[model samples]
Target: MRDDNASPDEPGTSTDRSGLSRRSFLTAAAALGLLPAGGRAFAEDKLLTFEKPRAFSFDLLADQARRMAMQPYIETKSRDPKVLDQIDFDAHWKIKYRPEATLEVADGSAPVRLFHLGRYFQLPVGIHVVDGDKSRELRYDPVVFEMPEDSPARKLPKDIGYAGLRVMAPDQKTDWLAFLGAAYFRSAGELNQYGLSARALAIDVAMPTPEEFPRFTDYYLERSTTPGHELVITCLIDSPRMTGVFRMDVGKHGPVVMDIDSRFFARDKIDRVGLAPLTSMFWFSETDRPDRIDWRPEVHDSDGLALWTGSNERIWRPLNNPPMVRTSSFADRGPKGFGLLQRDRSFANYQDDGVFYEKRPTVWIEPKGDWGAGEVQLVEIPTDDEIHDNIVVYWVSEKPVGRGDEIPLSYRLTWSKDEPHPAEVSTVTATRIGRGGIPGQPRPKGVMKFAIDFDGGYVAKLDRDAKGVEAVVNASRGELSNIECYSVKIGTAWRMTFDIKADDPEPVDLRAYLKSGDQTLTETWLYQFLPEPDSAA
Candidate 1:
């Protein structure tokens, strides 16, 4: 399975805010009288005002995004090292936002909360509130958020800015939306356990050059009259390479969704421009597991990369935790949609009660306009555990992005289990891997077996002796044998079974999808088989 946890600052140093150190803040908050006493609430105002915007417009934000792309990049640093020094993981956790301090905004007037800076997040960000056509910035004060008497956050200075912002639902007890770090933003998804994150844009990810992370330097929040729909947020993105303005429309129905529209201004030349970029973790699965030592059967935030190309083909590519960084791109005229999906939504698969992996939501992105010619790219990195994120997928455009160039992007982000695009044909439901050979005969050396199940439409019509139904199997460096196609008697689906005998350790590229004569019955299922220890030639 994949990993969780936001990218905090570097580990070890007490100054780094990225969720590493713990003990410093407690000692300091006690000396400064910032600690909450015996459940007593700290007296602090939840709402305050910053600089007010005369007018609010999406175009204006886009213009800003475009304009920033033309200038040199500026890096934001902590102003008060003493306060930033005191704020660590434990200190940030201790400085809780007062329930009464919640700023009532949209969603029929619900309070929105703010996240304070800590060791994991030391840089300051501007927070603002928008009401109707008016917008104002919020002041950061130590008294605004109530904390424990011994809490270290109280020792921090008043002007230390917030790391990010979060929006609460109708009830102020829980938050459903959070814009925490960088361009990293996410809703609780459908399952409420924040799974994958959608970024504003991806620049040079998995590139040989150092990756550049753009930050939302400032934000403007405003309420809308639409019921069920809460506030509209306008974010100002700044980086060394580009600047962008984003308007996010957030709401809740069956699940939370963010309708994002933005314009980007490039300040420097970019080798790779990623649209609708998604970050996820894929640690281990049945196919990738070296040894089944873990108690939990399967582990991963997402199982596959689901893509609906402009060619009207739905493709499912399962993720892998490769030995090194691997990137794959599928060229298309205009991608209909794509996303990193958590397809296996069964508690039985992940047995983790504390953090229910099954309930994690799958995010789908639908481009609003003609994306032109671009390829959806998938990047996978090797990870030993579920702590580091290793999976990334995004749409890359063919056109070059240079300084002063303005790019407009709009997309609908869906946080749900099932994708909106309905498939007429049944899809690959499960993939299982095991050692080849029967119990009676000696097992063939360097042989492996794969069992794949297709659960839906065309498969239900397949007969045990179907005339046209056939399994097409291909390998990169191996001989295929014992290939068989059969209709499972218990279910209304067909099964494609195959075994591979490889002479070398090179990975075998396997492609299989249901086909009847010249007609294609199912989406292509792509898998890569890694050679065993003793199989290397």
Candidate 2:
């Protein structure tokens, strides 16, 4: 929820250790200069320009990036520091850009609004409006916004430069597209709720070396000539390790989709680089509930990681609140798709109206080319609340991305409530953990019971009484007992029940999936069960 002082971009008020300060992470720079009455730059009606003159392709930008990588990295610095810092959370809300000042970057319903610089975002990015071979820079002006007389933003100077930019509808009522923070961007998905974020690239993430955050230093926002709503964006990315360029074609439908293409250049010897990285929050779910007390049942932006392999296998791994840092990888030749999904969409699960967790969007990434021989890596960090985005997934190529190499990567990002491709196979719906055995019947020595619900597909038409379903359960270091499977009456789903008795205090690796005769009914369910605590002798 946003307070009077917080910026509109704030998703929620969860504290985090993401190293981004409130001003830097939550708000873009928000102060501009006073323009002359004649509009010093040009009239509102001017065509935007690009290096290739409205040519919507990645070849030109990739060539620029490859040339940039041969040079050294240059950091950004603006004239004033105190003025930027003063635009903190509270002060940022006071520096809103006016709706009448939108730039028609495309023929779509959405118009472009530039963000000013504040205390946190001192680096100002240049915003250009492009059409055909014509392009012109959109000049910043302070008089456009309506701020209160006593507001703290009055102390800031004009011409400080804009921190970022956002895209609003033609009516200037709501923002549909936004590019605020470092290499991170998101559109209001089909549900109109912003959930996950997509990054230009990820370098040396989870590596021993300090993670390098590349910035999209400049952006060219172009409007389309055709009446149909279409816009083109060309961006330049820079970091200490590399520099790159990107061109994106954005469309608005039920869910905003971006056809993005980019090329990377390495400044130094590079070993690790993640293409099309996504960042999301995973606090707790049915499988990994928090120990500390809270009013709401669960808190998270996303619930599980869904992957579609090149072999056409669909895999779902429920996110967890691990005691220690964990990273998992699944190797593939050409992955069909992958995404971090917010599956538990029922409002009753959260029961909180303030922050609508049910409306958060799910992001799916579809590779444009054959990203041969790579593993989809998932990195999980321990998070106690919904603030910190502890879950990250990206495609890490098996072949190294080293110095003097230009890597061309392209993909389409889908922001929606469900995965891009629906599956005929059923999926694990719910997971529950409790003490083993009957209530008063001796409590079964060293066992703990687990109930897993699998829904979708032929699970509903299964033999209710004639042919009983089977539970193919296995544990790495435990004795499985009392395994059972039955049809769930509430919906067309099947329930698998089982118990495991560990011989020692060690982690138990468990895997199970339904199989009838020679055919498998669902994706394999994998779980890492930790040792249970002892109570009485």
lDDT of each: 0.69, 0.69
- Least well predicted 10-residue stretch by lDDT in candidate 2: 32-41
Clashes of each: 36, 20
lDDT of 1 by residue, 268-351 (tens): 889988878887767887665767557787777789988888988878888888776778888898788988788787888888
Please write out the lDDT profile of model 2 over residues 280-314, one tens digit for every residue. Answer: 77777767565765778877778888888999877
Q: Give candidate 1's whole-model lDDT.
A: 0.69
Give TM per candidate: 0.88, 0.88
List runs of model 2 lying over 4 Å from the truth: 1-24, 27-42, 45-57, 150-157, 224-229, 444-446, 466-468, 502-508, 530-537
